[model samples]
Target: MKFATQLIHGGPAVDPEYGSLCHPLYHSSTFAQQSMDHFGRFDYARSGNPTREALEEAIASLEGGSTGLAFASGMAAISSTFLLFSPGDHLVVCEDVYGGTFRALSTLFARWGLTVTFVDATDISAIGAAILPHTKAIYLETPSNPLIKITDLRQAAALAKRHGLLTIVDNTFMTPYLQRPLELGCDIVLHSGTKFLNGHSDVVCGFAVTADPEVGKRLQFIQNAFGAVLGPQDSWLVLRGLKTLKVRMEQSQSAAGQIVQWLESQQCVTKVYYPGLPSHPGFQVHREQASGAGAVLSFELESYILTKRLLEGVKLCAFAVSLGGVESILSYPARMSHASMPAEEREARGIKDTLVRLSVGLEDPADLMADLDRVLNG
Candidate 1:
């Protein structure tokens, strides 16, 4: 089957027991013992649930991986994946990473002795230079958060292999629909299903998928031990959201392209960041890897005063923290997403105070432009 078909029929779609179109939601805390000789495939809800298993299997298939594990939230998946490494192990990570991931590494993981070296991953050589003798893996985020920076996945994965290091990519921005890191020689792929994967913004979930069985086994153990598995209801919701992934992404991206063109034409906008733009730093590299530029873009104003006016004056788009919902969301990264980082560090990463990130929704391009135009000119 093709990619679009895979999204709907990727995993357990129909109820095997009743032939219902939707997968049945199994809410039991524990399963009954059929025989005393051995436990069934599902012994307890914490270890497994039919509904949750369906969602996990779907993500694994969508990501082209051998195994998939679900978690309560994006941070849970990230934290549990970090458990795969031991104390004293080193990792090389992208510089403009998600703040929650940064907090986990700089605070909790660092406290446990898991050292990390942050680099501008857009320059693949910077990542290579940061690799220490004990470096176990290289983590990356392409078309990175708020800033919309892109990292070349194939080159980064090859570099990791030469050093006998694992390549773990956070595939949240592109989703499996647009980019599959496992196909590019990466060992594992992670996602915050709260974003585009869930699409509706109602569910908070995460996934860890890997094509390697050994890595899959370790992550499965960590997920069960941590007991932060996504609940059955949220699992079903994500499953429902998966069916419409292609259409939603296409429409939102179309609107985003128009908005990018408008933002560039505006006199007040100082700079814009988007992979689809020809002038974008990694435009060609992104084209070679992912199928789309995605619906998110970032732009900077001449001053913080203009930034505040644009953010507070916007009518249609909600000035919010999260992205990837059907509704347009305008975010201030310096104060919203990257607030955890120190001032100097955020500035060094180029997450400026005047930067504004936008996640284009399914609204008409002209309507969104008018809303933004009214806000900017008013």
Candidate 2:
């Protein structure tokens, strides 16, 4: 089935017991057993739930993976994926990945005895050189957070395959509609359902889809052991969000292009990092892997003070941390998302104090442009 069709109707014909068209929230924490044997696949909510399972199946099918595991948050999904690696195992990761992922690897995971090497993923040689005998996985975030760096998933996946390393990707920005990393040879695909997948900024959730059954089993065990599974209402929200993903992404991407163009034309702006622009270094690599230049883009103002002024001055867009909401949102990565990383480390990754990232929503292009113009020109 096609992506759009599979999104709405892929998991089940309808809720089995209730015969409801929409997935019903199984609010109970425990289910009853008929014969003191297995209780029809779900015995506890922490282990599994019908609503979460339906959402998981939908994501798995949508991303063309063997199965999906839902989590409490994006960090939980990432941490659970990392749990597949043992203490002595090493990992190769993008330097400009999401802030929470970065913290998890550099701080928490490091404390737990796992070794990680951060490299510029766009440079194939850098990635190749960083690989060690202990390297068990490569964690990549294409169109990386704040910096908007694009990693060539096909090339990276080929390298991982040659080295017998697992490839895990954070597919939050592009969503399954634009990019399916697993189909491009990535072993596991992840999403922060709080963002574009939920589409409304009303929920925080995460999911991991895998082609390997062993990986799926390992993840399921960790999910159950750790108990970070998504709640029923959030699962329902994600299910509703998936239904309109194609339409919402199209609108968001269109508005983002207009915003990027406007940012490039402004005198106060120094540089714009967006895949849609010809000037973007990773434009070709991005186009080779994904369908559209996603809705998030970052630009640098001439001064840090000016950057602060613009963020505060923008009336229409919310000054916020998270992205992928239906309403326009703006963020200062230096302070908000990437704040956990030390200043020197963030600077090394090219996330400067003058940089501001925008998640373009479904707002009218003219209104967004006007609001931005007031900040850039006023």
Candidate 3:
């Protein structure tokens, strides 16, 4: 089936028992067994639920993966996945990963003895050079957080294969609809469902999916043991949100392209980072792998004064931290998404004080541009 069809019909579409169009929400914490000798598939809510299961199946089918695990939040999914490895093991991660992921690794995981090496993943050679004897995985965030840097996923996956390391891609920016990293040879795909997957900004959830059954089993074990599973209601919300993934992405991406063009023409703008732009360094490589440039872009202002004005003056676009919603969101990387990173380190990684990230939404292009203009030029 095509992607759009799969979004609505890929998983268990109807309530099997009642024949309802929407899946039924099984809210019980425990289930009764017909006999002690034989038990049902779901014994406890922590292990699974019918509502969450349907959402998980949908995500697995959408990403073309064998298994899908859902969690309470994006960090829960990532932290649970990290539990797959031992304490002495090391990991090579993209330099500009999400701030929450970096904090978890640098503080929590580091204390637990899981070392990490951060490198610019755009250079496949840097990934190879960073590998050590104990390195177990390569964690990446293409069209990376706030900055919009694109990494060559296929090449990086191949390089990881040679070194016998797991290739994990955070598919948050480019959802499964735009870029299926598993299809590009990545071992696992991760997502912050709160963003594009839910799209409504009402639910906080995450997912971890893998095409390899053995890896799936390992993650499933960790998910069950950690007890960070998504609730049935949130799962149902995400399932409803999945139905409109294709349409929402199409509209948002179209608006982003128009906004990027306008930002490039503005006098206050210094540099714009978007994979859709031909002048962007990774434009060709991104085009080779993904279907679209996604709905997010970043730009640098002439000065911090202009940046602050734009952030505070915007009337239509929301001045917020999170993105990928129906309403446009404007964020400051230095203070919002990447604020956890130290000042010197953030600058070294190219997240500047004047840099602003915008997640274009389903807003009309003309209105958005006018709102931006009043704030930027007024």
Candidate 4:
């Protein structure tokens, strides 16, 4: 089926209990067994929920993966994926990753004996040099969080395959519509469904899809064991949001292109980091794999005070954390999202206090541009 068609009708034919066209919420925490032997695919809410299952099935199909797991939040999903490895295992991660993921690995996972090596994932040679004999996997975010660095998925997959390592990609930025990592040979794909997949800020959710059935099964075990599965209501809301993902993304991307060009022309802006810009270092590499430049873009202001002014001055864009909402949202990585990382660490990766990331929304580009111009020029 076409991507758009699949987004709306990828899972079950109808709601199991109500026979409704839409997937119904299964709110019960536990299920009853007909006999001493458990029957019918569900035992408890943590293990399974019909609504959550339906959403997972949809994501799995959409991502071309064997199975899918949904989580309470994106970090929970990422942490669960990392759980596949044990103590003493090494992981090579992109330097400019999402702040929460950085905190999870450097602070939490490091304490558990997981050694992490940061590298410029965009440079394949750097990634190769960083990999240790104990390296179990490579975790990366393409068109990376604040800097917009693009990693070559196929190249990384080939390298991982040669060394018997796993390749896990955070596909939250592009969503399944723009890129399907499984087809690129990535072992697993992760998403902050709170972003593009959910397309609205109301739901905080995460999802993982694996091309390998065995890997999928192992992830399922971890999900059930860890019990961070997303609730039924959130799952249903995600399903609803996903229905309009194609349209929402199309409009948002269109606006982002315009915004990036405008930002580049502004005197208050030092540099604009967007894969859509032809001058961007990651532009060609990103175009080689993904279909379009995603909506999220980051830029550096002339100064921290200017950054604060631009953020506070914007009337239309939301001055908030997180991305991929119907309303445009702005975030300061240094203070809001990646504040946990130390100043030196963040600087080494190209994320600065003056960096401002924008999640372009569905609003008219003209209005959005006018508001931004007023803020910057005023």
Candidate 5:
């Protein structure tokens, strides 16, 4: 089946017991067994739920993975996935990864003895140079958060394979509909399902998917042990949201292209970072690996004054922290996503005071342009 069809029919879509079109929510914290001699597939909520199971199946199928694990939030998914490594092991991660991930690794994981080296993943040489004898994995976020820097996933995965390291990618910015990293030789695919997968912004969720059964089993163990699983109702909501993935992504990507063009022409704008633009550093590499440029883009203003004005003055786009909702969201990395990082470190990673990231939504491109113009020109 094609992507659109798979969105609707993939996984355990039909209610096997009730014959309902949508998967029914199984809210019980524990399941009953017919006999003590034989345990059922699910004994406790922490281990699994029928509702969450359906959503997990959908994500795994969408990403072409053998297994999927759902979590309460994106951070939970990421932190738990990192648990797959031992304390003495090291990891090479994209320097511009999402702030929450950076914080977790630099503070929590580091304290636990999981060392990491941050590198500019856009340069394959940088990734290779960072590898050490203790390195166990390479974590990446392509069209990386706030900066929109793209990494060549296939090349990176190949390099990891040579070093016998796991290749894990955060596929939040480019949902499986746009880019399937597992197919590009990545060992694991991760997502902040709160973003595009749940598109409506009503639920907070995350997923870890893997094509290798062994990796899947390891993640499943961590998920169960950590107990950060998504609740049944949120799983149902995300399942409902998955049906419209194709249409929502198409509309948002179209709007983003229009907005990128307008931002490039604005006098107050100093630079725009979007894979869709030909001038973007990873334009060709991104095009070769992914089906679309995705809906998020970041731009730099002429000054911090202009940046503050535009972020505070946008009338149509919400000045908010989260993105990938039905409404456009404008966020400041220095104060929002990357605020946890030290000033010098964030600057070194190119997340500047004048940089603003935008998640274009389902709104009409013309209205969005007019609203942005009013804010920037006013």
Candidate 6:
């Protein structure tokens, strides 16, 4: 079936109990059982809920995974997955990974004795060199965080399999609509549903998807034990937002392409980092692995003065903390996204002080470009 059709009909068609088109929300904390000898499928809301189950099944179908586990937030999902490894185990991660993940690894994971080696994952050889005998997994973010560097998912996942290590890819930026890592041989795909999947920005939720039943069982156990499962209301919100994902992604990507072209002509903008552009180093590789370039892009200004002006002067695209909504967002990476990293570490990873990231919205391309021009060149 086509991806667009899958978005609407991939999971449950309607409310099975009521025959209603929309899935019914079960708001009760606990389900009553007439007999203690045999209990219902879902005894507690944390363990399971009808509303949450529907959303989970939808995400699993969209990502081509056998199971999907939801969490309170993106970080909670990531942290719980990391806990799957024992204390002595090691992991090799991308150098420019999201700041929140980096903070968790450097602080909490470090204290727990789970070591991680940071590498330039764009170079597969670098990943190989960093792996240790105890390395249990390879974790990465393609079109990585603020720098927007691309990692070859196919090659990386293959490398992990050869080493008997699990491969985990964060699919928040691309979403399942643009990229399905499990289909590309990845063991796990993670998403911050708060961003694109919950396109309205009204919900904060996360998902961990896998095709392997054993891994799914383990994740389900951790989700229940950790007790960070997403609420039924937020789960319904993400499920509803996911229905229009295809259209929203297409419109946002089209506007991003136009904005990339306009940014190249401006003297104040030093460089544009977007996989869709022909000049991008990963353009060909990205095309081979993913269906689209996605809507998020990062750029650098020639100087701090110009960067500050563009971020502060923009009226249309709000200078904000997060990305992937109907409204455009202009974020300062040095402060907003990658601020958890130390200044020196951020500099080494090429997240300079003048760099800013943009998450294009469904706004008209001409209007978005004009707003940028007024700020950068006025």
For residue 212, model 3's alpha carbon misses the true position, in angstroms, by: 0.6
lDDT of 3 by residue, 241-358 (tens): 9999999999999999999999999989999999999999999999999999999999999999989999999989999989889899999988888888999889899889999999
TM-score for each prediction?
A: 0.98, 0.98, 0.99, 0.98, 0.99, 0.98
Question: Alpha carbon lDDT of residue 368, candidate 4?
Answer: 95
- Mind giving the per-residue lDDT tens digits that candidate 1 earns over 211-321? 899999989999898899999999989999999999999999989999999999998889999999999989999999999999999999888998898899988999998
> In candidate 6, how many Å is residue 14 off?
1.6
lDDT of 6 by residue, 162-196 (tens): 99999999999999988899999999999888899
The digit string of per-residue lDDT tens for model 4 on 1-378 reads 898888777766875667888877789899988877658688899999999998999999989999999999999999999999999999999998888999999988999999999999999999999989899999889979888899999999999999999999999999989988999999999999999899889999999999999999999999999999999999999988889999999999999999999988888889999998889888888998999999999998889888889888899999999999999999889998899888999988878889999999999999999998987887
Residue 355 of model 4: what lDDT? 90
The predicted structure with the larger lDDT, 4 or 5, is 5
Instruction: Predict model 4's lDDT versus the native.
Output: 0.92
Ten contiguous residues with the weakest lDDT in model 5: 9-18
C-alpha lDDT of all candidate models, in order: 0.92, 0.91, 0.93, 0.92, 0.94, 0.92
Model 3, position 122: C-alpha lDDT score:
91
The per-residue C-alpha lDDT of model 6 at residue 271 equals: 93
Model 5 local distance difference test score = 0.94
The best candidate by lDDT is 5
How well is each residue in 1-378 modelled by candidate 5, as lDDT tens digits? 999999988767466678899888799999999988999999999999989999999999999999999999999999999999999999999999999999999999999999999999999999999999999999999979989999999999999999999999999999999999999999999999999999998999999999899989989999998999999999999999999999999999999999999999998899999999999899999999999999999999999988889988989999999999999999999999998998999989888899999999999999999999998886
Off by over 4 Å in 6: none
Model 2 sits at a Cα RMSD from the real structure of: 1.1
